[model samples]
Target: MERTARIDTAPADAPLPDGLPDLAHLLDGMPGQSRRQDPQARVAPPAAAAEAAPAAQDRLRPVRPWRLLPTRLLPTPRATPFTFAYAVVLAVTSLVATYADPAVVQALQQGSSTDVAHLVRHPVLVLVGSALWIAGGVLSPYTLGFLLVLTALERRVGGLRAAGVFLCGHVLATLATEVPVGVAVATGQLPDTSLHRLDYGISFGVAAGVGALAGLLTPWLRWPLLAWVALIVGQDLLSSYDPLTSWGHAIALTIGIATWPRLRRAVSRTRH
Candidate 1:
């Protein structure tokens, strides 16, 4: 009997188990083996999807505050004491005008020959009663815009200065436009019948208020407002319809713009 020494026959990379012989089984258990994909398993998205991912994220992201409800975009940001009172006056006057006898309302609005004659004589009180009076039944939009602009100004500057600006614009605009019409009637540029036109409305005051508010606004805002106002006035001028009202609005807006510097200073001092 002769003793036989055993010799090993295996690859250098893998040691064979004493009983191992199948390479196929070993290949199946390797880390790199490709298994049939489970239909539910997440796979990398296609190129198109990857490209759209950022857009989806942007849509999901919360909106920035500046892009949301900004204060600058809002009018009458909050109820102001002066604003409330002013609104009340407008509302009350509007109601009175709405329900009043048509004849009486017309008489009050158009300034009868007697009223105009008297107002012209005084000149001082011409804007007194008419400032709050809306010739056309009290409109909600008029009230709303008036309230917003007036409130914003009252909130920024004290009521006194706001009042001053309002009066300056209202009284000045009234005297400037109406007096001309009166003078025109006197001068014969317009018929004496024109003096009796229904000229009463908050439009003058509202225009002034809007002008003053624009003055307080940031430069970006101020320009747009002025342009918008200019557009309305320009349109009226070009169309050759009611040029007087447009001129009045322009004059009032100018007064408001001029008062801007002082209004700003007052607002600054208020902060201190």
Candidate 2:
């Protein structure tokens, strides 16, 4: 009889022979096969993918230095309403000071001056008027400081609070300095002319804004700013060019510092 070849096949569930490799294991190592089996390899949800797209685009975009300069130098009406409106008023007054007749300018300044005489006669009017005209017009350092500092302060604490801080400094410092002059005049210690001296500007308010803004800044920036202000005011005090005004600046700065505790709490509440 002829010998026939014998054939055997393993069942589907049967284990492979010892010398053979697993076909299933080989298939699982493939890119497509592995992705199907792995949960993390699945595509992200639509919402997540949408969220990531903008961030990726932002990362790839190049920065333009020219575009950033104007934003830094100027205040926007929506973001800093108080500063923008006040700046417009200041600009108008500055133009008036520059173009108006010398006699007219002098008369306006005299009327606006928060001197003891004006304060006593029309406390409300002079106090409000004095702040309208910058002493050295729009080109003054204080005007620039008022723009930058008040804008920054308003951004942090809001327009109303910023206005309050400015007014507090302006009104209080004026009263603090002029009240003493008034007492001296009444006591016969100073000449009557001292009561009517030309004293009108935003310097006191700006000084206070600097002090208040310092409190909100990081310690590194805060201390240096305070030092610089102190140095400038100190030098002015030493020079004795306008001792009363310098003293008023110092007092206004102190008032701003005094508001730090309250300001911090308000800021914390707003954040929460």
Candidate 3:
């Protein structure tokens, strides 16, 4: 008959499977063959303790920097109340100009010089009128209420960039409309004069500015804006070639596309 007895060397303080001998008790007992440590047994580290090292390393590592800083700086961050007020004033003046002496307005609409020029002969009024036109016609009404838009954009991208965007779009639209119409009329394919006295006061004003904004903000929209301008110009050329109806918008768009970069720089400088 043979007998096998094993002694577990567990600590008294440790939770045991049944009551077992502590390390102190085991050390005091016989170092028996049945109590010998197994060679295959591994002293495994605690899972939570093992996981903590990587977590601490991750916390110490540097994070990636943001790449979109330039784009974020494109617009000014603050709102400007003055710009909105300016837009409203321009809108009111534009309506007044249209309503006051509808006959005189007819000439302005025709894009020609006649009695209206005689009436607006005063240099100050002319200056004022021109300013008004820039605000009401060229910027606000014509450019899709971009005068107001420019303010918001300026607060984000800055005023100079906003102004550049407005100017470029307006000027480009104007050129696109004017150039082909003038050529067609000169060639005698179209009438000598049609709606001569009028000008495209607003026409593609807002649309052109929007197009410029699209160009600046989203590159993909640039092609569509350009196509729209081309189509409008082509239609104007095909038709009577009137400046008011088409040429002005063409001109505005041309200027906008060409001068946008310069305007942006100018705005940046001004802010600085």
Q: Which candidate gets the maximum lDDT versus the true structure?
A: 2
RMSD of each: 18.6, 13.2, 17.5
Query: Whole-model Cα lDDT per candidate?
Result: 0.69, 0.88, 0.50
lDDT: the better of candidates 1 and 2: 2
Alpha carbon lDDT at 61, candidate 2: 76
- lDDT per residue for candidate 2 within 1-272, as digits (tens), equals 99997544545446558997665654532344321133335678999989987887776678999998666556679989998999999999999999999999999999999999999999999999999999888889998899889988988898988898999999999999999999999999999999899999999998988999999999999999999999999999999999999999999999888889878888889999
Any runs in candidate 1 off by more than 4 Å, and if so which?
A: 1-79, 111-118, 122-125
Prediction 3 global C-alpha lDDT: 0.50
Candidate 1 TM-score over all chains jointly: 0.66
Worst 10 residues of 1 by lDDT: 68-77
Q: Which is superior by lDDT, 2 or 3? A: 2
Output the lDDT of residue 144, model 1. 62
Cα lDDT tens digits, model 3, 155-255, are: 64555555555544544444454455566766786675631433334334444455445445555766785786679677886797553545555655555
Tens-place lDDT digits, model 1, residues 49-99? 788778767766777788744343333325355656766776787786778
Reference-based lDDT, residue 50, model 3: 84
